[model samples]
Target: MLLNPLLSLSRSPSVLQRPSSLLRPLSSSNLPPIQGGSSSPSLYCRSLVQRLDHDAFLTSYFWPAGRKKDAFFALRAFNIELASIQETVSNPAIGRMRLQFWRDAVRDLSNGLPPPLHPIPLLLSQTTTPSTRDLTAYYLNQIIDAREANLLDPPPPTLTSLLTTLSTTSTPLHLLSLSLLTPTPPAYITSSVQHLSLSIGLTNLLRALPFHLSRRRAVGLPLDLCAKERVVMEKVFRIASGKEGGEGGLSQVKGLREVVWEVAVRANDELMTARRELELEGGTGFPVGKEFMPVFLSAIPARSYLQRLEQLDGDAFDPSLQRRHWRVPLDVWLAWRRGRF
Candidate 1:
């Protein structure tokens, strides 16, 4: 899905109007039956998420088997569906149309019905009971609105605007995942969850930057941060996308590495804050239970990614940072056992 095109310093700061919050009546009866996908419900969602995005697969790999995996796969499948739009579509207008379709689909799901035209929402609906769907309906639609908000990239954002962008686009998914893991989520940890989710969202935004610029020729870096380091968008796009092929692409930019470090430091602060909040002692948040572990495991990838960014010395276009590192499985395993991520 189009990430929060980050709150651009040059762009207008218009917030998304939530259709879910508006309380408009929905005529879900007109929703069509799911069509076109041959895979079974769970299998379809599972395969879709795995093929398109393996991070969630690794995160959910540690979850206790059965219903939890099914539910999370459905959730990540929907996320992948939204995330792929900007990368795959050549035209922004077509992307908008597809996003509108998903907006409608989420509304239908909120009404205890999912559009039959798409397998993702259909399978997601089936994975959970109607009552469970009802509870998650608001957050579900929020994600659609977040995707819709960023369909057209605006100006580079301020740090505040960037975080707000993520609070909607990313934070809700974490909350929903936690809900899926346990019906009775701890009330006090909402702040911690929001912190961790926002941090992960920012980290992913950084990870996806090269892709965003390469696929669409647009940079999503917060404008304020880019300014402090005088990052040049066009050069960054070429280098990060590997279109620039001298030995040292990172050296081409004047301050790209420093810009990346600024963002990384902010992300690191958020990550450490989340860890403290989730700490079992002298912390404001609750202890993470084994059942709740999978939802929080996202921190592992975020941290590993940050470390990689550091390794590259903040060169946003470094080739070594593009591929998955060898130490990821070990990082994930250690995080799982320690309940630290």
Candidate 2:
């Protein structure tokens, strides 16, 4: 979900600019204690590290143990922080500025500067292997590319065009990162990441559709194209509902709620297909495909959330305030992680 002003206020620019706000006084003295000489870590940096550590512990069990696990955790943390900054900034311009800060930080890392006091950079520096520095730089560039893509409205129709737009953004870099984490690069890594990112973008687009349709808004996407996409999506939803299977006595309620499930199933299918293609392409020696398994499993939680919504709202299928319906993807992510799927 996009950050509103209220959410962004929690991490206001003023707070970010003030180093004092970021650090706690060690002794009740007016003078702040310095660590590593002119490189005292910020509270935000510490907190971010802690959060990353926690998330890593929870998710990294799936990863092979040792340095590989550590590297995977670090990369995952960096990606989370990068994505979070965009979602947390209240103003788009400020978000862009934060992203640029990241770009500079990445460049600085290449120069052997102690990681920036900022958590993301610090974590990235810690995880970066000498061999992977170039890959790191490339990945950082991808984040910048994604931010740039976000600034523009949705591009014109055609899957080719959309894929092109996505290629320039975070998707390909994410695929590359997945490739790096594995013992071997899988051919399907690119397709899987592409499909996953697109699935996420499409779901996000769906959530925003009602508002766009009602307001006649055309932010980065043409209304006609959006309409067409929605129609396809609706078909996708029906398939999810199992109505297309010709199973009689399937409750209409199931059909109504199938939109959420359909998205998940389609995303899973894309991921599986990508994995198969990668294996067929002689990329089977690497763990690249396995890296994306968790991401694909994320859909289970999304479907669960939809079920909860159906029970609670009962009228969740109605065409009203779709924006209000967005929830924490993490909730679904956690649930899926716990085998709740």
| Best-performing candidate as measured by lDDT | 1
TM-score of 2: 0.53
Instruction: Summarize candidate 1's per-residue lDDT along 97-216 as a digit string, tens digits.
Output: 998887777777777764565667777677678778776778878887877777776755798898888888788888989888888766646567788887887777677555556554
The best candidate by TM-score is: 1
CA lDDT scores, all candidates in order: 0.67, 0.45
What TM-score would every model get versus the actual structure?
0.81, 0.53
What alpha-carbon RMSD in Å does predicted model 1 have with respect to the real structure? 11.1
Global Cα lDDT for candidate 2: 0.45
Candidate 1 residue 249 C-alpha distance from true site, Å: 2.7
What residue pairs are clashing in model 1?
1-82, 1-83, 7-157, 8-155, 8-156, 8-157, 9-156, 33-116, 34-116
Candidate 2: give its CA RMSD in angstroms: 12.6
